[model samples]
Target: MFQFLRKVLMIELAGLNRFLLGQDLDLNIINSEVSRCNNNILADLTNDVLSVKSKFADYINIKLGKKKQGEKT
Candidate 1:
């Protein structure tokens, strides 16, 4: 699901880059800005995935501890 969403986002970004390039903008400047935007998007995606993974790990730990406590009784 995440992969699919990421691909879609990338395609959209590529289209945006193409559109920007089609304008009266300088090729070098548009390319640079597009690259920067792509990097920022990737960084944001990585952070979001890491945050979700951390929360899931915490939840699993808490859930397993509860099970262990029940078994002890």
Candidate 2:
């Protein structure tokens, strides 16, 4: 799923780069900005997934009558 998202992002960014190039914009600046934006987006996405996975693991533990670390019985 993450790979798919990365591929789509790459394709979209490529198109944007071409469009900006046609407008005579500085490709280096555009690429740097895009790279920063892409890194931020992916990092946020990873954090969100980790949070959800943690919550799901807690849920499963509760369902199985297991105590999470440092969790009260």
Candidate 3:
């Protein structure tokens, strides 16, 4: 699933790159859509990483009780 998503993203990026290099395509529309898609992808990835980190931290604190000194949970 992840690989397929990555592949699609890569293909879209490549298409944008080709357009930038003077490919025979509608440059204005491609530029706008590609920029939007890239931004959305980046935001989603950032959110996913932060969520995973938070979950891991919770697991560690609950299972191992490795809270730092002077920290309250």
Candidate 4:
């Protein structure tokens, strides 16, 4: 289901976030593996940040009354 996939994606992303923060920018095989499992529900997992972006945008706009110079959210 969507919820289960989202939970798995979140766990994967937590690990991925650590790798990225540690400067381990090499997700080649990982990318391929995930792509191989892609589906509509899985695709939503990838757009997770956009959800965060929309939330952040609303929060920032409400607080600042406008978008910042180059802010995405």
* Per-candidate clashes, comma-separated: 0, 0, 0, 0
Which parts of model 2 have CA positions greater than 4 angstroms off? Answer: 1-24, 66-73
The Cα error of candidate 2 at residue 70, in Å, is 22
Score every model by TM-score: 0.79, 0.60, 0.56, 0.34
Higher-ranked by TM-score: 1 or 4: 1
Candidate 4 colliding pairs: none
Candidate 4 weakest ten by summed lDDT:
33-42
Candidate 4 lDDT by residue in tens digits, 1-73: 4577678877876675555556644577556544554454356765875787788888988877655534756
Whole-structure CA lDDT of model 2: 0.74
Q: In model 2, what are the clashing residue pairs, if there are any?
A: none
Per-residue lDDT of model 3, residues 1-73, tens digit only: 4566668768877876676657565778667777887788768866876787799889988766655533654
TM-score, model 4 to reference: 0.34
Q: Flag the better candidate by lDDT, 1 or 2.
A: 1
**Models, CA RMSD each:** 1.8, 5.4, 7.0, 13.8
**lDDT at 21 for candidate 2?**
62
lDDT tens digits, residues 1-73, model 2? 5677668767876776676567755778877877786687668777877887899999998876655544765
Show the colliding residue pairs in model 1: none
